[model samples]
Target: MRVLVIGTSGYVGSAVAQRLSAAGHQVVALIRPDRGKRARRYEWRIGDLTDPDSLTAAVTGDIDAVIHAGTPTGDATVDATAVAALTSRLRGTGRTFVYTSGVWVLGATGTATADENSPVNPIPIVGCRPDIESQVLDFAGVGIRTAVIRPGIVHGHGGGIPALLVDLARKHGAPVVVANASVRWPMVHVDDLAALFGVVIEQAPAGTIWHGVSENAVPVRELAIAAGQAAGVGGEPQVWPLSQAQAELGASFADALALDQSVSGHAARDRLGWRTEHPDAVPDLREGSYR
Candidate 1:
C-alpha cells in the first residue's frame, strides 16, 4: 500500500511512518512547504493541513491510504475543512483515512475505565475533536475506509510529555505533578502507537475506532518521581497547585494534565492483535529514554 502520512516529522508520525515503511508500505510524507525535506526514507509531498488546496494536491495520484497524525491547526473549522479536503479526494475510492485523536475526549474517567465504547466528555483542549471524529467516521459511508485512533498521553524516545516532566524537574529542582498526586494518565509508547496505526490502516473495517493506549492508568506522582530520577533530582515530586499550573500552562492544558483517566486499549489488542512492546513507562522515564 502506498500510504500518505501527514505530520511525518512529528514524534508520533515519524514513528508511524517508519513502522509503515518497515511493514513494506510505500510511505509518502505530506510536509508543509516551509518545512522543506525530511528523511529520505519517505517519498515527500508538499502540503499543509491548514491549506485545503495543498492537502488536495498531496492526496492524489495512486495514494492507497492516508494517516492524519498532524497537530491540529487550533481552529476547529480549519481542521474540519482539512479533513473534508483529504477525504473528499478519497471518496468512493475505498482508500483508508485514519484520523488521530486523543484520550482526553473521554474526560476525567475517575474510577471506571473508559474504552472505545465510552461516551465522550471532552475537555476544553480537545472540545472540538469529537465533532471532527464524527466527520471522519462519516466518510466510511461514502466508500472511504475511515477510522479514528484516540491515543493516550504519548511518551518515549526521550520525547513527549514525560520529557516535559524531566524538564520541569530540572528547572525547579524537583519533579512537578499538576493538581494532586492521584491524577492518573493513560500512556502509550510512540513506537507501539505507530504500529497500531499500521495495523488500522491496513486491516480495520470502515468507521472503526481504536484506543491506542497500553497502560490503562499510571499515577502522575509515580511518573514525577521517575522524572525526578531522570533529572538527577532524586526526591519526592512537588505538587503544583492547579491555579499555579494553570497560570503557567494555561487552564485547558493544565486541566488536561491533572485529569484522572483509566482508558483501555483492549479493543485494539483483542480484535487486531495489536500488542504493545513498551508496556511499562516508568523505566522509560527513569533510566531509558528521558534519562
Candidate 2:
C-alpha cells in the first residue's frame, strides 16, 4: 500500500510513517518545507493541512491510505477543514483513511469503561471532534474505507505529554496535576499506538472507531508521581486548580487534564489481534522510554 502520512514530522506521525515504511508499504510524508531536509527513503511532499493545494498534492490517486496524525491547535476549525478536504479528495477512491481522534472525546468515563460504542461527552478543548469524527465516518457511505482512532494520552520515548510532566516535576518539587488526585486518564505508548494505526489501515472495516489505549486508565496523581520519580523528585504532586491551570495552559488543555476516564481497546485486540508491547505506562514513565 502507498500511504500518505500527514504530520510526518510530529511525534505520532513520525512513528506512523516509520512503521508503515518498515512494513514494506510505500510511505509519502506530508511535511512542512522547513522539515523537508529530514526526508529519506519515503517520499516527502511539502504541505500543510490548512493549505488546499498542498492537501491536493499530497492526496493524489497513487496513495492507497492516509494516516492523519496531525494535532489541532487553538484553531479548532482547521482540523475539520482538513478532514473535509481530505474527504473530498478521497470520495470515491475506495482508499483507507484513518483519522486520529482522542479518548477525551469520551470525556470522564468515571467508573465505567468506554468502548467504541461509548457515548461522547467531549471536554471543551476537544469539543469540536465529534463533528469531525462523524464527517470521517460518513465517508464510508461514499464507498471509502474510513476508521477513526481515538488515542489516549500518547506517551513514550521521552516525548509527548509525559515529557512535559517530567520537565514540570524537575522544575517543581512535584509535578502539577490538574483537578484532584482521584481523576484518571487513559494512556497509550507511542509505539503501540502507531502499530494500531498500521493495523487499522490494513484490516479494520470502514465506518468504525478504535481506541488506541493500551492500559485502561491511570490516576492523575499516580502519573504525576511517576513523572516526579523519573525526574529525581519524590512521588508527590501538587494539585493545580482548574481555573489556574486553564489560565496558564488554556481551557482545552487544562480541561483535558482534569477529565477522569477509563477506556478499553479490546475491540481492536479481539478484532485485529492487536497486541500491546508496552502495557504498563507507569514503569515506562519512571524508567523505560520517558527517562
Tell me, by TM-score, which candidate is best.
1
CA lDDT of each prediction against the hidden true structure? 0.92, 0.84
- Among all windows of ten consecutive residues in candidate 2, which has the lowest summed lDDT? 33-42
Number of colliding residue pairs in model 2: 0
lDDT of 2 by residue, 9-40 (tens): 78999988888888888988777766747737
Kindly list the per-residue Cα lDDT of model 1 for residues 1-291, writing each as its tens digit.
999999888999999999998999999988888876756667899988878998998888599999999999989999999999988889998989999999999999977999999999999999999999999999999999999999999998899988989988999999889989989999999999999998998789999999999999999999999999999997788999999989998999889889999999999999999989884788899889888
How big is the positional error of residue 215 in model 2, measured in Å on the Cα after superposition?
A: 0.9
lDDT of 2 at 65: 89
Model 2 misplaced regions, further than 4 Å: 34-41, 73-76
By summed lDDT, the worst window of 10 consecutive residues in model 1 runs over: 33-42
**Candidate 1 lDDT for residue 246:** 93
Could you give me the TM-score of model 2 versus the true structure? 0.94
